[model samples]
Structure formats: C-alpha cells, structure tokens
Target: MRSLTEEEIISHIPELSNVTLRKITKGYSFDLKYVTEWNGKNVLLRLYDLDLSERVQEKVEKMEAFKKLGVRCQDVYAFGEVPEENFCYTIFSFLEGEDGEAALANLTTEEQCAAGYEAGLDLNHMHELRIEASMKEHMAFIQEKFEKAVERYSRLDQQIPYGRKIIDYVRNNIRLIGESRLVFAHHDFHAGNLIISQKKYAGVIDFNRCGVNTAYSEFDKLELFSSRLSIAFSKGVIQGYFNNRVPELFWKIRSVHMAQLLIYHMNWVTDYFPKDLPQAKDAIQYVWEMYEGFHRTIPKWYEERQA
Candidate 1:
C-alpha cells in the first residue's frame, strides 16, 4: 500500500483543519489514516489503490444510496477523485463502536439477539431499496469473473473432489441469483462490519463491495456470520431481518454465495497452506458440509421461491 503523505491527504480534503495523522497499517490494498481535525472531530481518511478507481467510484455511489435508504454507515464528509495521484478517496466522520463480534462476546445471549436483530433490520431496509438497473448491466466485469472461477475450479477439482461439488453449486446458483430482485446489498456483512455502541447497533462499515445485487447473496453472508456465532444468534439475525422467517429462496441464493466463499477458501488453502497440513483437510471438510446442506434444502428453497 502506498503511503499518502499527510500533505497529500490534507491537500485533497480542505475540511481537515489542523489535522494530525496518528496511525497507518500495512498488508491492505488501501491506506487507512486516523486523523484529528482542527475542529476537534476524529475522522478516517481512506485512500484506495490506484488500480481500484472503478471500485472506489462504485463504493462512493453505493454509500450515498444506502444512506438514502436509512442504512447506518459512516457519514462521508467529502469524497472525489484526486488529480495529483489519480486516486479516489473519501473522508468520513469517525464512528466509535465495538465490533459486533467483540460485543457479542461481552454481552449475554439476549443482548446478542437484540444487536443481531438490529443489524438484520438495517439489512432488510437495505434490500428493499429499488435498483433501476440489473447486475447484468456490469456483465463485462461480473461474467468474466465467474467464467474464470469455474475454469480454475475445474482444474482444482481434479486434485480434490470437493472443489467439483462447490463448482457445480455455484454454476447452478449464480445464474438463478441474477434473476433475483436487484436491491442494494452489503456483500460483506459479517459481525466485523457491524458496530455496537451502548449495547445497541450503531453502524455498519466497509461499503467497498456494496451494490445492487441479489438478496440471496447478502443472506449467505448473514448465514455464515450466524453459524460462526451460534444458532440462536443466527435465528436472532434472521428473525430481526425477516420478521421471524426468511423465504426459502433466500437460502438457495445463500447456498450459491457460500459456495463461492468455499472456493475462495480452497484457493487460499491450496496456495498458502502446507500440502500435508491438517488445515487443508479441515477446509475441504467444511466445503462438504456446505454442499450437503444445500443439497438437502434445495427442494424446500424452490417451493418457497414459487410461493
């Protein structure tokens, strides 16, 4: 990640009067800076990679749309393209809240349920936002991604049969999901993205991948978050968002999304993990569980979608 001199960041956004840069982290595509402004407000200045021009634009637009839909997120103070470095960046008001995961660990189940439900409510509102355009409108970008993923998985499946099952699941589902109602969705809505303050939901962050997409894609993420915590937590999240019931088709869409995550994990394990490590076997085992779950539930999912 390129370090933006305090001078460059301050030059781009004039609102930071008497700002002081406090910290910067590495190992990410973007640069994160915690700054203290002259006005006594804490703010975060996010500068994207030069290669992420399109993603930055999409994020800016999607954040505006989500705010219009009443989805809680960091308030954008100012954002636009910076000509000097040819990068897009945004300045946002600092939001202070414990991550939902940390909060979950500290709170009782009842409190966890409440926070999860609140997150769900916000997600529900987000999914209700009408998108005048279809995701296919970005076919040149999305279609090629899937095509390459499928081809890569085919080669990997020859080495580990689990990869084939995941490939098949995604092939069958991504197309069906495209046919779903295109609503604004936070593709990454895990506990990490949620913030809780004063024992209640405060905000959600990281809208970098937010867009008009399938409701199912979003649900899959929620499902994974729920699984990571507890069944009760998951139920709380589902009930909070769907009024105690999520449509079956929601799960079907989730199945496809989960399969995608699994494939990504497989690649990570393959490339990063030692070949004989137990970690590799565990990762593959998880994929099998996801496959079995989807297979057993697809008929019910179809019935729900039909209804």
Candidate 2:
C-alpha cells in the first residue's frame, strides 16, 4: 500500500490539522504508523488496510481494556474507518522512551531486573481481564495448534536438534494444557516491545497482537526473546509475576511450552521468516541446555540466580 500523506491524514482527522507527522518505520506490522504532536502531547497515528478493519477494532478495544486495568500502554484518542480512502485509522497517545531491548544493555543488572519486575506487574494486571472461553474449549484450541505445529515440523527439510525428543516431551505432558487458565495476554510481550526511560520500563506498546490464551503461554517470548537479551530481567519477570515465590507447576508447564516452541517456532521461522531461523535455532539450543535436555523443569538461569 502507498504511504498516507500528511495532508491525507489531516483531511481524515481534522483534529490533527497543522501538526507535523513523522513516519515511524521500526516495527514488523504492515500498518503505516506516524508520530506527531497533537494538543501539546505526542500521539501516534496508524492507518490500516480496510480489510483489517475488524482486527483494528479488536486491537483498539484491547488497548482500552488494558488502560482501564491501569496497564501502561497507549490510550486511544480516536478510531474510525475512511471508506473512500479504503483504510481505517487510530490515534493513540505516543509512549516516549527508547526501546527496552536496546536500552537494557546499558542498564545495571539491578535496573534491568527492576524494569522487568514492573513489566511483569503490568502483565499480571492485564491477565485480570478474563475471557469467557471454557477450559475444554481452550484446551482444544491449544491442542489443535500443537498438532498443526507437529505436522508442519514433520514436513520441514531440516529439523531442529532434538526435534523428536522435544515433540515426545510435549506429547507426554499434554495433560498440562488443561491446567492453564485463559486470560487476555499481550501475546508479544518482550524486551523489544517494551519502552525504557532512565533505566526503567516506561510502558508497553504494539497491542495489535494481543489475544486470549493460557497465562503461562504468555511467557513464551521471555524464553525465546527476553532471556537471550538479559537473563536477570527475564528472571525478574517470573519473580514479579509470581510474587517472588515461583511455583513448581509453572516450571513444568513452561518446560512443555518451550518444548513445543522448539518444534513449532523453528518450522515457522524457517518457512516464513528465514532471517530469524538462526535466532530461533539459538533459542532452541539455549532452552535444551537450560532445561538439561528436558530432564529438569526449572532452567539453570533462574536456579543459579536464586542461589
């Protein structure tokens, strides 16, 4: 899709008239985003293809829900579709700060952990907005995804190391899928999606990927992304999420989830995101070593830190 001009934006949202719009090109989402000053405050403008109107509406609702729950995220100022333009738009209060992934490396270990702790607390609040899916329905949804992942992995030309073992481990522990309680999740909560200001987590962004899922499943990105960036911060997220006394069952469920990711995510990246294949492989290896080839539930990073 062609980029939306500044005049077009103003024409669609008259409130943004006379403001300067600077295009933001830092994310993977297909939506066109721009930042500008509106009424003495920075605001974000996102334009989406008309076909994505429903999804855009869902994202806006989730953002509103998170705001009402006191989670640090974007606040919607306006949202609507421009039928003539064949696009939908949303205006949100812009979160100001450096991306957490880049900023964490410059922070002290304690600071990184503290930022992660705050992020975890915010995530806990988000989970309080429960979805109405039954346990049986949720389990079926997870199981179906797992089966599809397994089938996709089976078709891969080159599978990940310990692929069969990971598949077997997940299948053996399949009953754990029923133990999870479904809740609204950020779905892409990771250091990269976080905003850090002065060595602290300022807020989270990109709720476009939010959805209802098992609460423990929400930590998948921590294992796959955050830990690789800062183990201390990753540990802090788990610590704050569980109020510092980690549950044994959490470790068990997390292990199964990570195992499934080793099979499913690897195939996914290989197929659609080949550039991320190496990172995905590295994450798989890290998980295998951390869990001692699935012999343990708690990872060495969290265990050593506790010691």
Per-residue lDDT of 182-272 in model 1, one digit per residue for the tens? 6767877777778889888788887766766666567664544444554445556677888877777766666676777666655555555
Residue 1 accuracy (lDDT) in model 1 = 35
Q: Can you give the TM-score per candidate against the true fold?
A: 0.79, 0.92
lDDT at residue 9 of model 2 (Cα atoms): 70
Clashing pairs in 2: none
What is the TM-score of candidate 1? Answer: 0.79
lDDT of 2 by residue, 1-307 (tens): 3566788777887567788889998866778888988789999888888888998888899889889999999898988888878888899999888887889989888998899999998888888885787878878887888899999889888787688888889989977967878887788888888899978889999887777788998898888788878888888888878888887899899899888878877877888788877777888898899999999988887766521
